[model samples]
Target: MKTIERRSTCPINYSVEIFGDKWMLLLLRDLMFNGKNSFLEFKASDEKISSAVLTEKLNTLLNEGIVTKITSPKNASKFLYMLTEKGIELVPFMVEFLNWGSRYNPNGGPKTLLEKIEKNKKKAIAELQDNLRSQRHSYTNNPSDAF
Candidate 1:
């Protein structure tokens, strides 16, 4: 019998450490799908994350370099959060989750998105990245569009 050792400290384990929590993925999902980018927006999610939990997750994501907060020019007191490249790179993981859920759960979610993902996995991921890049550029050039 042979025993296997982790390769380079387990990349999946490291990611899971940062985002394996119940709501962390949901937070990422909202950012990826619904374009949510603020404390208030995340709080207003249909899943109804509590304020404390949301705060903790947001802080954790920030500390992990997956997200960054920029002060809103229109409102000095408010901040707009966005995914870093590291974060946006998780699209495949999210897509896989959606595909798995669509297969196993099959109760909710946009069947159209799921079908697109299923039918054209590569194109779907590419479109997601392109959209994120466009959104980032738009938000930076026109901060008001951050909403």
Candidate 2:
């Protein structure tokens, strides 16, 4: 019998190790698609994630360098969490998952985005990347400029 060494440096495995959980992906989906930033927004999503679980997922994402928490300029008491470049890079994985779900589940999500993604995956990825890049730049230049 031959034993294979697990590669720790593989990017795919690293991503999976950090964000393979169901709720983590859902949280990222909320950030990516819905443009949610606040804790209340995340909690009040269609998925209805609990407060405690949401906190845990957010912390995990932050620790994994997938998400960053920024203090709200308008309200000093609140924090707005946004995805990092690494997190934005998960768009393709999200699209593929949505595609698979739509195919098997038959009533997964909005057919328009899924259809658009299926038809032109490159365009979809590009749009997502562009959006993330612009948002990140704007946020960095002016912390108040967030979607």
Candidate 3:
């Protein structure tokens, strides 16, 4: 991990420094919800992040101990990204963030998911966090496989 400069010792400032950018959150969102693992999958997201930017952000995530890269078992040439325990802990925050976004953005986000989250926030967060932690390196999109 590279040395990071801090503006202050505030936790809020620390979070902002780590995840203030849209790209970082989007990358995490894709990883958590979309079951995206490879660089190509991230590149093909609706956000259309550039390769250079994606590489830089992914490296930053690696350095921050939030994400880890693994050699894909099926493809020697490709690498798959997985969330660390630290990253899995962010599941609650992400669930709330998604709820907030879905509340304001009428056309965005999954309505069914939003309803489930609204119905039981704690259960939703717990289920997601458990799923992320249990999956480890398996980034399958199938709910049965992941859960």
Candidate 4:
């Protein structure tokens, strides 16, 4: 596999090189938060990402093995995109970002989400991780559907 040449071996630099884009993070947000499995669904996000940009970000994540695109079993013409095991493992980190943003930003997101994160921080992360981990069960939305 090809690797990105960077200035140093710092872990933060490596993480940024792989996932620094705002749009890509939004796509992951949609997948992990909104249960968006379709291109249309991703495109319909509040951020309104352009088709070209979305395609590029998806390809990058796909290349990094952070996500997988599989043909929809219910409809061959469609595709379902989900986080890979590696991506699923990022749930806690992502949740931490959410927590950080809610803390610093004056205008917070959903109150329910904030309250849950505050009230049962560990439990919330565990539940989310459990959901994404279950995606290995072939072609089933059973994992993310509960969210």
Our model 2 lands, by Cα RMSD against the true structure, at 5.6
lDDT of 1 by residue, 1-147 (tens): 222233458888777678778899999998888888889999999899999999888888888877788887678898877888888899999999888877887485777787788789999988997888777766778877755
lDDT of 4 by residue, 1-147 (tens): 445578688999978988888987788788787778788899888888999988888887888899898777766787778899888888888888888988899998768766888999899878877776665454565533433
Per-residue alpha-carbon lDDT of model 2 for 1-147, expressed as tens digits? 222244588978866776678898888788887778789999888888888889888888887777888777778899878889988888888878877887899567867777778789889878977887777677656866653
How well does each candidate superpose onto the true structure, as a TM-score? 0.86, 0.83, 0.89, 0.85
Query: Who is ahead in TM-score, 1 or 2?
Result: 1
| Best of the candidates, TM-score | 3
Top candidate when judged by lDDT against the true structure: 3
57: Cα error in model 3, Å: 0.7
Error of 3 at 69 (Å): 0.7
Better of 2 and 3 by TM-score: 3
The order of the candidates by TM-score, greatest first, is 3, 1, 4, 2
lDDT against the true structure, each candidate: 0.82, 0.79, 0.85, 0.79
Once model 4 is optimally superposed onto the true structure by TM-score, how far is the C-alpha of residue 43 displaced, in angstroms? Answer: 0.5
Q: Clash pairs of candidate 2?
A: none
Model 4 Cα shift for residue 84 (angstroms): 0.9
Model 2 misplaced regions, further than 4 Å: 1-13, 144-147
Which ranges in model 1 have alpha carbons more than 4 Å from their true place? 1-8, 144-147
- Cα lDDT for residue 123, candidate 1: 96
Expressed as tens digits, the lDDT of each residue in 10-89 for candidate 3 is 99999998899999999999988888978999999999999999998999899999998876666668888899999999
